[model samples]
Target: MIVSEQYGELRGRAFAIAYRMLGSVGEAEDVVQEAFLRMHQTLRGGEPIASPRAYVATLVTRLAIDQLRSARARRERYVGEWLPEPLVTGPTPAERAELADSLSLAFLVLLESLSPRQRAAFLLREVFDYPYREVAEFVGTDVDSARHLVARARTRLRDRRPRYHASREHREELARSFFAAAGQGDLRTLEALLAQDVALHADGGGKVPALGRPVTGRERVARTIAAGMTAMARFGVRLEPAEVNGEPGAMAYDARDRLVGVLGLGLADGRIRTIHSIANPDKLRHLGEVSDLGLRARAGERPGRET
Candidate 1:
């Protein structure tokens, strides 16, 4: 009965904020629902929120900051290579690119290094384009402190952030090639597609077998990927291509069709630069039921051996 157009406009934006901050879709949804509920309750009580957007955003920001504080502890105990839960996008891959990749696995991993306040400040000021004055108010700090928070976050992320390639078409082609090459255990093709300094990161979260450290350099990454494909083949797992976090990606499902892993790549200069694979069962839980029988069938046309 309390539905309003304003709430509709705010819903996606609020979810975006929460998702970017927490790097977990479930937590972001919960925070948004809770924030909306609180805001709705106040409205029902006849309170006047002059600036609903700012009021709601402030609430979401504070709540997300608190959640990050608590979640950080859990992450520390998490098993091998903790990657952000991948966000498998929808039908419109082209439209989802910019917004989707903003939540890219690499970016989220960088945010994890920041303190709660710094993360909140960085997201608010940079990602959301919030003014320092308002960002200060949201984080319960002065304008100067808010600026410092954002600066600190940038400093930490400067060297870590992925250099996103601009050509979406080229990147997609590169990703598909890498996926196919790795699946077919085509090391030569994989080597050609991957940069000499390519890095492979797998986040199994201690729940499954994954690399504890990043596999760096072209040769090591190529072999590691080949080995993974072999394992997937041995276990009868199949991969389906889809838009992941606004870019090309593959989802691997087990023999029972249970979602096992999601792979997203960072491409640059027409080469696969970074491979972020999330095989943590918990992380894949948000992907729901995915069947890629069609993609599996289409693979027959590609000139590569079965994985």
Candidate 2:
């Protein structure tokens, strides 16, 4: 029971670490659960293991690294642009702001560009605040190699991330306006709300058809959104606002309550700069369970309005 309680207490942070590493809730939860199982077995075996928390965390991190390595092949052959499965983060705590910021879809997308080892090394050293020595231990490298890995990762990530810091209320408000305008197929309003260099990326993962490449520029993105919203509406799909990854996002549901897709937006200078759509059924499996957005969407939404 003490072991179980310890596992429970550490589960949130464990899940957070794994999720940030792998960008998939189901995969992260699997890693966390496996770590707990291993820890429980080791404890029950009467083995002398010190610091259950640290041991379990390291175990989870290594497990997530393996998962990331294996997941890369599928991602390479992915139908469209691959995206991190949305985690549907709720209100951010001031104390956990660092963790919250690292979970953004845009940030996760940037992390995706790195190799599995570099990602693990960088995440451990940077986001999780582990020292270079510890990050080396986590990624199974020397301290110098770990430092090099983090530096390379950081250089690659620089300027690839959104200029974050907008209030959730502002993001949500903008999301509401964007969806309403897009739902109505109002190109003028859509263009006005979009940044000049806005980019829209859709991930369907070959299970379904989506934009194979990013649609960039305000005019192009506006055309894509307007056409997409209109086409979805014709197919009985409805778009409703839902908070995703601690930012304003939307949830799409068909008339029969099946989830169509999940979307997250990156706002810069109070305008939508990046739009991410995840329609891959494989990636979306956990959104039904982990996504608070799913319930409101399943409950029902009115047409052409914010939820």
RMSD (CA, Å), each prediction: 5.6, 5.1
The residue-level lDDT of candidate 2 at 127 comes to 75
Write down the TM-score for model 1.
Answer: 0.88
Report the CA-based lDDT of candidate 1 relative to the real structure.
0.80
Per-model TM-score on C-alpha atoms? 0.88, 0.88
lDDT of 2: 0.80
- TM-score, cand. 2: 0.88
**In model 1, what is the error at residue 134, expressed in angstroms?**
1.8
Q: What is the lDDT of residue 274 in candidate 1?
A: 83
Clashes of each: 0, 0
Q: Flag regions of model 1 displaced more than 4 Å.
A: 1-3, 91-97, 290-307
Question: Candidate 1 on 1-307: residue-level lDDT in tens?
Answer: 3357877888888988999899998999999999999998988899988887888899999999999999989988887777788898764555554654467777787788889999999998887889999999989999999999999989988877766656667777787788888888999998999888998998866656678899999998999999889867765778898777776788887666767778888776677778898876677767886433223433443223333
Clashing pairs in 1: none
Worst 10 residues of 1 by lDDT: 294-303
